[model samples]
Target: MISLEQKHHSLLQEAKRRTQPDIANLRLCFELLALTAAIDRDCAVRLAPHNLSEGKFVVLFLLHGQPHGLSPHELADRAGVTRPTITGLLDGLERDGFLARHSNLQDRRKVSIRLSEKGDATARTLFADHTQWIGTLFGGFSSEERIQFSALLQRVWRNTDAGKMASPAIAGET
Candidate 1:
């Protein structure tokens, strides 16, 4: 079987022949995608046994220290997801008895979310495990290297022009 790196090299070679693409940029992008996919896969595996999706786990993690809980909108913002997505996660969590929604005393329209007893326990365990897992990912790097790597990643993140690109949908797809 061809290794992933070898496959990427073959694909890049084909790309060069077909379009004469910028090899460095394309390789970097491919590497980033591969890294993201690996992290996502690992996270999914880790969360599976606990019956949590990454989004649900993230919500639980964010709610850990909030004594007064968070509004669904606030959770959405902090989680960097849309309100509807957060609502769906919230619905699932609530159904699973992992979280509680409380109405504000002064305003019936306002609802705050907090973890159920079970959620608190699960979050604590997951948080510690998550911290350890994250550390291990960067364990080979020195402190200075980690800082420099973080800075470089932030720079790459800020340099995106993707927001201006047109969607890849066919004209009649919508």
Candidate 2:
């Protein structure tokens, strides 16, 4: 029996020939998607033994930048998550003793969050380890290739118009 990978390869080959309007850009999109998934999978594997997810890692990483602490609103904006999503992340972090939430002195309505001692150590270690891993992963690429890919990705990012587009699922509702 043909393996799943074989089947996927066949499908992509067929798609290249038969896709509607013969858009060549789909190949680039697929390549980008596969590259993205591989990077995400590798990162997830590296963080797995520590019981860390990308979201948690991002929170810790962001907290490290603002040692004085960040407000939930600030985190939401920076993390590109909804305020409620940040609340969920904070709840887990607080429960894990990775961070603490304190009432903001400047605004009674807002709360500030900062890493605990344990959180700081974990974040720092993970950041260093992951930085090394990232460097190793990209070591094969020459400086020119890296620069070209970065520019290409920036163009694709702008093409998405993500900042201006509404969530696809909710677009009709609004």
Candidate 3:
């Protein structure tokens, strides 16, 4: 595994060699990418035992909170995936009896996605475990440190114009 120090050293060298403008900002972005990758891996590890993937878990988590269900387009927007990709994710969940697809009476072409009874229970169980895992993961940080870290991350998100651009579909996200 590449440690943060090694990553920083490599990025610093690249920046110096290229004489990159905004070296400090570039370095900060690299570090943040590394940190994000680490967190994503951890989340995946925690979700795997529950037979959940990051994408699936995110979909279910969103569905769990909305009893009325969400349209596929809405799920695509909220889950940060393309519409076809959302279909595949929802397909497996539905096949396993974790979700349901409802056609709009007014427009048969329109469909809403919802968690089924089994899916809801399964997701709830996984969520409890995942929540505990997250708590443990961040346990090293004191309350103040956690606050500061969250603030820093939020600032980075704002600085990066995260989701500020048009929808990923419009942006040609695949």
Alpha carbon lDDT of each predicted model: 0.86, 0.80, 0.81
Give candidate 1's whole-model lDDT. Answer: 0.86
Candidate number achieving the greatest TM-score relative to the actual structure: 1
Error of 3 at 3 (Å): 1.5
Worst 10 residues of 3 by lDDT: 165-174
lDDT by residue for model 3 (1-174), tens: 435657687878888999988887767777767877898988888777666788899889889977889998899899999989998989878887889998989999988899999889888888898888878878889989988887776555544555456465533332
> Residue 162 lDDT in model 2?
76
Off by over 4 Å in 1: 1-11, 19-21, 162-174
Clashes of each: 0, 0, 0
| Model 2 misplaced regions, further than 4 Å | 1-10, 13-25, 105-108, 155-174
**C-alpha TM-scores of all predictions:** 0.80, 0.75, 0.68
Model 1 worst lDDT window (10 residues): 165-174
Candidate 2 lDDT over 31-89, as tens digits, reads: 56667677898999998876778888899999995778999989989999999999998
* Candidate 2: residue pairs that collide: none
Worst 10 residues of 2 by lDDT: 1-10
Q: TM-score of the candidate numbered 3?
A: 0.68
Relative to the true structure, candidate 2 reaches a TM of 0.75
Q: How good is model 1 by TM-score?
A: 0.80
